[model samples]
Target: MGILTSSKRNRRPSRNSYTVSSRPSSPSGAANGKSFFAHVKTALSWTLGLGLGALLLVGLALGGLHLHRLATTSDFFAIRRIEIRGTTHFNREEVLKAANLQVGVNSLTVNIADVERGLRDNPGVAAVAVKRRLPDAFEIRIRERIPAFWMLKDGVLHYADNRGRTIAPVSVGNFLSLP
Candidate 1:
């Protein structure tokens, strides 16, 4: 597009007055009114669209935060049952105490890494996985260290692994004797 401007000069007894005018920058656009209005309309529509998109993005982020807060702190997500798996050495109470889990606690507030770390503190836990089943349950999977031999130290029976490390203490009610 190009601009075409004209000026009109008038002479007076003591002063000169000049007037300036403007037209479309393009020669073809000067005669085409519909195309010019259409371009303006399209630009307006595009600006409105971008503004709406930004509003929706902000709304979604805020809604997600509110929902997350609800999910984490609500009593509806309290723990009701805990399912323990793949444990032949450690019992349910032992595992729960090690993982620091108790019934009626908020399930969503439980941290997987912290639970895994607590479980790993047990000498018998070779590998452990903790998962939350939303709204009321948890799944605990464990891989226990195999005992290579039994050791009696300080009048206590302890199970030792192949690396000569103490795996766990032998319980009276439940005992696995190893030569």
Candidate 2:
């Protein structure tokens, strides 16, 4: 069915300032009654304003939550344990010392770049990967420095890894036993 239509005598012009007159009183005011486009434009403007405000509020709330998460300490809620693997040139103690990593430090506080720099400082470590094992653990996987060649000086022979750092001393050993 079509829209309900009222008798011409039953409806009165609206008192709203924006509402147009039902009958044109002059030549310039040729248009009569509210134009379909004018009603659509007013409705759209109201909807657009409301929508924009709602979006802005949502954005601000999200930003605040993100800032809070960044500033708060996650370590208090999570525990971290570390395990080292694939190390041969350096002992566990030496590797740990070089890494400068403390057991009690928060995993969230772990800086990847800093850890990498510290681990690389160890002559026996060529490369390292530090990973967070979720709620309670961290894992360090290292590529042990390779024994590239042996150098002899002052009647003593020293073993050098891939980075040419002395790892151990040897007097007389076969070349095959270097690495």
Candidate 3:
């Protein structure tokens, strides 16, 4: 009777038929058939958050450096002295006043290139150099425009330099004659 019962149990199920039913399968069957895009959205959010945080940190560092420079340099507010050289036609006071540089003004407030440009704007000045002498000083150096030739155009006196740049025309009596 025991041998007959074991044979009956072994012959119960066939290849095509079983007591348990197979659940219906989906193309995206992982985790109850969710799409792949749902996973990607979560990963991108984390990456973007980290990138924005890093950018903010860099901006703050640059701002701190600029503020420190402003605090340390006295040149940021005033100039203490002015030095002039290589000039004869223009007096020291005339050039300084024209440059709009004031004694005791902030050194940082002045643009040396701009000062040189202002000096050159004077008809008599050929070239100009504006430099910081350190601690509390500015140096203004200039070269005078030399007369190389004289020309009379319709009775107007014009002076030309060696390079043919014409100086301002004035009365013939005051016009410099080149040697």
Candidate 4:
């Protein structure tokens, strides 16, 4: 009983307390939660700016697509003439037939490498160079293989170049007296 009384006399009891503060707000009266409204206004402005930027990007993309369509399909881009250079073994008709090209085709639709590949498929063609004359023409230069020997195959004679590479089969139109 004496020990209990001594501990109770030395210890102090705890109590609850409240505090008050004076925080400053904007110079313009912000009593009605104006700070919240300002935050909302800034967020809306950012969203609106982002939306406008996206719309501008979409408009530019659409404009580019429209211009590409117009350029590729317009008659103004149609080929008017084709110039074939360096043709020795094949004629103009044969070269065009090999390249599968014709006038009035869209210039933009023509693939230069494809045309060269088509011409190179022929055994007589050793090398090829193709050029596009903008807005309506194409120029192709073909280096033909000159026959270094005459090869006889199954009673028919074919043209052969220096490396024993066979050229086209000899026909009346492309006949050459080669040893």
Point to the candidate with the largest lDDT: 4
**TM value for model 2:** 0.51
Best by TM-score: 4
Off by over 4 Å in 1: 1-39, 85-93, 146-158, 168-179
Candidates sorted by lDDT, best first: 4, 1, 3, 2
How many times do residue backbones clash in model 3? 7
lDDT of 2 by residue, 1-179 (tens): 56656775478645788877565475444345556677788899999999999999999999998976764456562445678899765576776677777666656666768878998876556679987776567788999767778877577887786666875575443233754
Name the better of 1 and 3 by lDDT: 1
lDDT of 2 at 18: 88
Error of 3 at 22 (Å): 26
Give the worst 10-residue stretch by lDDT in candidate 3.
12-21
Q: Candidate 4: lDDT of 35?
A: 75
For model 2 the local lDDT of residue 61 reads: 100
Each model's lDDT comes to: 0.86, 0.71, 0.74, 0.87
Q: Please provide, for model 4 over 19-41, each residue's C-alpha lDDT reduced to its tens digit, 9 standing for 90 to 100.
A: 33245656776655477678789
What's model 4's lDDT at 99? 93
Candidate 4: RMSD over Cα atoms? 10.6
The parts of candidate 2 lying over 4 Å away from their true place are: 1-72, 75-79, 148-158, 162-179
lDDT of 3 by residue, 34-104 (tens): 56777677678888888888988898998898876774465544567788888765677788887878888
**Of 3 and 4, the candidate ranking higher by lDDT:** 4
